[model samples]
Target: MNDDRRVYGTDRGEDPRPQPGRVYAELVGGPLDGQLLDVTGWTPDAILDGAALITEAGAYGPGGRALYDPFPGDPSRWSWSGDTP
Candidate 1:
């Protein structure tokens, strides 16, 4: 479990609502770079596997990994806190 979860919010001035059937993933440097991927219906495990193929699937740090936060909030979101282990 790592406290490396990223916090997403309206700081970028974008709409805060999450698109249904998709989850946002922060893209790192590369093609489709610095963009957020709306991972369509993909679970945490699926994202990890698909990330290798999907350039849209990405993370902030070196590992290119993350998990969605179970607790939903307004204008903000968090990744799963304990999955980093």
Candidate 2:
């Protein structure tokens, strides 16, 4: 098992306990070298007693673009919100 764990937000804030809604997802294959690849995005339900799409299927980032702009590894590379990349 790759044992990959990824989450955009934490349960303490994003998802409160007691599970207020029902979630859904569609799983794609994994990455090479035994890496676990999973993409997730949620949609809120608008109606009464109706919940949002907790997880949308195929909502992952586009692949093959080689977009790897990550958080600045060096403090010098980092910039404030007011600054441009």
Best by lDDT: 1
Kindly report which residue pairs in candidate 1 clash with one another: none
lDDT scores of the candidates, listed in order: 0.41, 0.23
Clashes of 2: 4
CA displacement after TM-score superposition, residue 5 of candidate 2 (Å) = 8.2
In terms of TM-score, which candidate is strongest?
1
Q: Candidate 2 residues 15-67, lDDT tens each?
A: 32122233322122322111111212422222111211122222333321111
Cα RMSD, each candidate: 11.4, 16.6
lDDT of candidate 2 vs native? 0.23
CA RMSD (A), model 1: 11.4
For 8-32, candidate 1 gives per-residue lDDT tens digits of: 3334666544544555665434433
